[model samples]
Target: MENMIKKIVDADNEAKAMEESALKEKEELAKKIDEETQKIYDSYMKDALETVKRNDSLEEKKAEKLWEEIQNKQKSAHIKLQSDYEQNCDKWVDAIVSRTLDTNS
Candidate 1:
């Protein structure tokens, strides 16, 4: 009976050791999973930031090009208006003088 009791005590001790080892392994696995998740998140954020920077640069270039085009169009229109005024100034002055001096209604 004493030998049987010793055997049972040994078995119980071994079972407790196995349980402790399993709990330690579970905790280590959980920690590794958290670390890997953080690394993936960081990588994704870095890639997303790079993409946004590239898109912003492209948009800025497009806006600058559009602004230059508008400036060129405005300059052209101003030049044409000045040319028109120079060509028509003499004719307009003569017509106005004639209209003002005419007394026969």
Candidate 2:
């Protein structure tokens, strides 16, 4: 009967040690999973931010190009108008002189 009691006590201690080991392994696995999840989330956010910055830069470039084109068109129109006015200046002056100082008077 004393040998049987010793066997029972040894079995109980072994079971307790196994339970403690399993619990420790579970906690370690949970910590590793949490760390990996955080890493993946951080990487995804970094990529999203980079994409937004790239798109914003592209839009700014497009706006700048459009503004330059508008300025160029305005400059071309002004130059054409000035050329037309210069070409007609002599005729305009003659007409004004003929109306103001008429020899028919």
Candidate 3:
């Protein structure tokens, strides 16, 4: 009977050891899963930021092109105004010169 009790005690110890080993394995697996999740999250955030940067760069280029177009149009308008002013001044000067010659005569 004593030998039988000793065999049962040995079996109980073996079971307790197995339970402890299984608990340790479970904790390690949980840690590995958490680390993998964090890595995936970091990769996703990096990709999203890259997309945002590309979009912002495209928008900036488009805005710069629009501004350049507006500046060119303003330059064209200024040139036209300058041409008109020069023509009007020439006509006025010619009229004044003719009037002065007529008065002198």
Span of 10 residues, lowest total lDDT, candidate 1? 96-105
The order of the candidates by lDDT, greatest first, is 3, 2, 1
Arrange candidates, best TM-score first: 1, 3, 2
List the candidates' TM-scores in order. 0.82, 0.69, 0.75
Per-model lDDT: 0.97, 0.97, 0.98
For model 1, how big is the CA root-mean-square deviation?
2.6
Better of 2 and 3 by TM-score: 3
**Candidate 1 backbone collisions, by pair:** none
lDDT of 2 at 79: 97
Instruction: Tell me the spans in candidate 3 whose CA falls farther than 4 Å from its real position.
Output: 89-105
Candidate 3 lDDT, 1-105, residue by residue in tens: 999999999999999999999999999999999999999999999999999999999999999999999999999999999998887988888899999999999
Error of 2 at 68 (Å): 1.1
Query: Between prediction 1 and prediction 3, which has the larger lDDT?
Result: 3
**TM-score top scorer:** 1
Better of 1 and 2 by TM-score: 1
TM-score of 2: 0.69
